[model samples]
Target: MAIALNTKLAEGVQKAAAEAGLAVVNGQESAGFNGIPTEKYTLALVSAPEGHTFTLELSAGFDITAANIAPAVRAYLLESAKRLTNPRPDVFVTLGGLPVSFTNWQWPFHLSVSGADTYVVHGGATLEDGKTAADQYLKAKVSASMTVTFAEVVAAPEQPFAEGFIYNAVRKILDQGQMELTKSGGNRQVVPVTTRYYSAKQGKFIFNDTTAQQRADYLLSKIYWLSGVLGGGAPVWIADPRDAQYLNTTVEELKKTAESLAGEGILKLDPKFEYASSTEPLMAHHAEYEHHLQDALDFTRPTFNEEMRAGHTNM
Candidate 1:
């Protein structure tokens, strides 16, 4: 029986050896053995003289010729035994996904107010004002419109606007009650006024138009901001649905390329092997794997008696 050279099996062995703090080189490559280019030892698969089974061969004198061979070989054999308990014929590989970037820009706004409020200024009598006292105070104390940027909002780890920062700012300015004037028992008294007299038509406000069309417009503008910023501040051309059409098309093209390569006899794909599609969001995949790192000590630490027994047996 001819033992096939399984790339995945080799990769798994390499992974296990690396986890055990072993330096490994795949295939019979150049450079050096035991940090010396003059000496070399390569690991390969070989068949027995009777051709009954296959065995792993670490080239001539490898047992004592190569440094760190004992621990590496032990790790490889232990992992190989574990893999034999449960075998998978197919391999899962990840193809590249679209990249995104972000930028910031200021947006414009305009607002006005009209209302009435009674107040006592310098011990004067009650006065009827056309605009609420709070509106006048804000107009004179704050800028006509503040600069609003979306960079941080988009990059926030939590869902955008979930912190209530923007909403709080708007509420503080337009909804928070102000101390105005009121007449009680023929005497001017300062009382809390919770009503907002300003009507913002084209600017940020605590309470603006809540129509369906207005809400849709607001959502679409935020979407536009995300797309523009992520596209490096340049206009992005994207489909309306923004589905994974590009990924699907790329996968189809890759299948075609693989078929072409197989026809040229450069590679082969088993008849049982089939292409798999991913429905997971591209961004979610990035977030999932961003912090996934392997540590050698994590694998080397003694955890279970069975695993320790296996390691000792392999050694």
Candidate 2:
């Protein structure tokens, strides 16, 4: 059977991958991200020849090409494996969400006491008593000095980002961005985490802290109010499909489930990257590179799931 996939799924997968790429570009860690950055994620397409039905599913923890993909994808996969050459029933696809895994946190802390006085200088007391006998100008002074000490607590950012939701939102943004690319070349390139640190201890802080903060703020701006302009973090735009309460289980499990469909022969996993860029934010344009990479994601994306699961609502 010739099936048409939903563009939303492709949109979700692509957005997620691009965001992953963004994390590496910004010199942030992507691995500890609850498996969103892992290579285990998968997308599957399954076929059911006997029933003349097709299925598409996303696995939780395994690769889409592996033998443990989701049930629906398995059906379509087997169907594709069978002898069906009329319309050449196999199709390739991808999707995305957003890019920035975490938003910009101001993380305000007092680096200096009133900031001006980073040090204290001890001043010796001046002696002013003179001419004690006949006519004298009386003056008394205490020989006391002042000592300066510095104190500050370790300061860092704390995020309230919902782990699964953040990933899901980014996936959607990237998936939408993917539709604009040509398979040959020109992808959203992410800077490696090895690039540079924007934090204060780098000693580079004296000159660039403001600049770094500005850059961080700029990228965050794109995801925030602007996201409303594009539709982000919304209940309808930011829920991960792996919600067992809503779907069946966790994304990790779903990934494995999605991967098994490949054994059944219909699913395919594409190692792809999503790159985000905007003409605005003159500062972010210069921070990471010549332009601002709003966010990026790398994933074993689901392309056919876009086709089969077209009826469901995205969040």
Candidate 3:
């Protein structure tokens, strides 16, 4: 899989200097290509191959724009070029975002590619959160990359937090199902089952078959048709969204916490929903959870309890 690294990428030193209204010390641009130039005249008869080289060196107290940079870059080097491994700087990243500025907006990022001849790669980083600045860049690799090394600095993009695909899809199905049900329901056990088949020669044995699928289809055709498919699994809906993590992070201590938090006079509470299914959709069952939680908290609200003051927690 090719993850494009074209976006608002900047050197740690350059970023800090620019934020402080200070100019970059001396910005230079370069491109590295990987693979052989077989079509050259020297390789006409045989499959002899060669690659080219280019470099941009700047003087002190200078800044270079990303646009003026060359389209082709050197990714793999020949004997004439120098190769070195440098230090890894402390960096906060924000990847896969749109541009925010004209000057420091686009990055003069060095990139590598494979398969496709050339395509746009964009990226950036977050010093803090998704504010203040975004360093981005894009480049079409002169040749598809087998491996790459950024002589200067290569920016890592933002890692996804709430964008997990499988879990998100599961949650959507559950939430939509809850809307369809419109009624609060209790939790369902996620039973893992296997089929036992009769085998006279080998005795009865546990086996894998399409029985579960057939059952699911029967239910759908006789009762309700399935709206979608999540990978190979049948689409299912739930009435409780307090326990829905099919992706990202899931926990098993939610019920225990809910029971512990449930008290004498509270109705519904707003604790970190730490169920096994955070990716589950919001269900009508959760509406009652609110009431139960509020009652738990207000159980002693008339007397002003410290715990009822809404504690700050990061789960």
Candidate 4:
């Protein structure tokens, strides 16, 4: 079975190469009877440039099948195109006060065959050998030459706040019950709980059921506090005009501070703020809330709140 599959694969590759206007010849031939190649072939020849030509060998265990061979051949052709088009970059790393350079010229192309996944190997045993062989082959066939260069190291600027600060702040707000966290599952997975609030102001500013007037007051208080801490020019409110009652300072300064805090990773105060208008209404969004409550009941098995317990009794 294995030998037949191997033969079929070799024939498919040979046919595919022939159709692509390339001549492919078997590398391993039988010792007797007109030197015919063995069914378990080892090598092949393709028409390439004179001095740049290199051999590409694809080998598999005897259990290999024709389905396996087809994708391997396709991957080989694709890899060849990639090498010719966007040659891999050279990398440099520092170790012990010395700069070490390395080049990667080959990549593994994965394919699934007969419900089993397999990878097609490029070059020979090692990457260096593959690079040399591929470079030679490309040079002879297409006069292609690859350049070697040093890699640059880029350091990200340090942030002002600790890592996960925004995540922790959001989680803390959720825990405070400012918004509802409902979990629902589908598609063989549990979707992240949807965080819903009655108003967009609540969603963005992390406020509870405060009235719009109260929110405006709260904003003014925050601006004053921020101004004191930031050494008091006039207090600036970087809030939507519809939501703002007190605008003692220019919107430009508000935007400037917002941008600075966001860049320093201290806060994310941009378009997420614009999402305030789409806030879900309380009680009307009961289907999602019930789904989440049921999920909680099944998983945690905790005592229900009076409302939930009474509802269950009615049901």
Query: Best-fitting candidate, measured by lDDT?
Result: 4
Error (Å) of candidate 3 at residue 259 is 29
Give the alpha-carbon lDDT of every model: 0.25, 0.24, 0.21, 0.27
> What is the lDDT for 95 in model 1?
15
Worst 10 residues of 2 by lDDT: 122-131
lDDT of each residue in 135-223, candidate 4, tens digit only: 33211000011111100010110011111111222222323322222222111111111123112443232213344344333332233
**Cα RMSDs of all predictions?**
32.7, 29.9, 25.0, 26.3
Clashes of 2: 93
Better of 2 and 4 by TM-score: 4
lDDT by residue for model 2 (1-315), tens: 222323433333333323322110111212212233211122222332232212222322323332332233333233333312211111111121222212221111112233443321111111111112323321111111111221121111011111222223223323444322222313422211111211335422111122333333422333222222222222111112312112223334434443343233322322320112222342232344312222322222335566557865565
The global Cα lDDT (0 to 1) of model 2 is: 0.24
Instruction: Please give, for residues 1-315, the per-residue lDDT of candidate 3 as tens digits.
Output: 011222233233234323333332233332222221111000010111122211222212222233322111111111012111101111111111111110111222123343433221222111111122323222111111111221111112101111111122222222222211101211221111112122335432212122333322222221111111111122222112211122111123333333332231111223442211111222223344334323432331234334455664443
List, in order, the clash count of every candidate structure.
1, 93, 51, 6
Stretches off by above 4 angstroms in model 1 are 1-55, 64-67, 89-92, 95-315
Tens digits of per-residue lDDT for model 1, 211-299: 43332222222222222212222222111111111122222333444344335443333342122111123223333222221121122
| TM-scores for every candidate against the unseen true structure | 0.15, 0.17, 0.14, 0.20
Best of the two (1, 3) by lDDT:
1
Model 2: residues >4 Å from true position, as ranges?
1-184, 187-192, 198-220, 223-226, 232-315
Q: Model 1's lDDT to the true fold?
A: 0.25
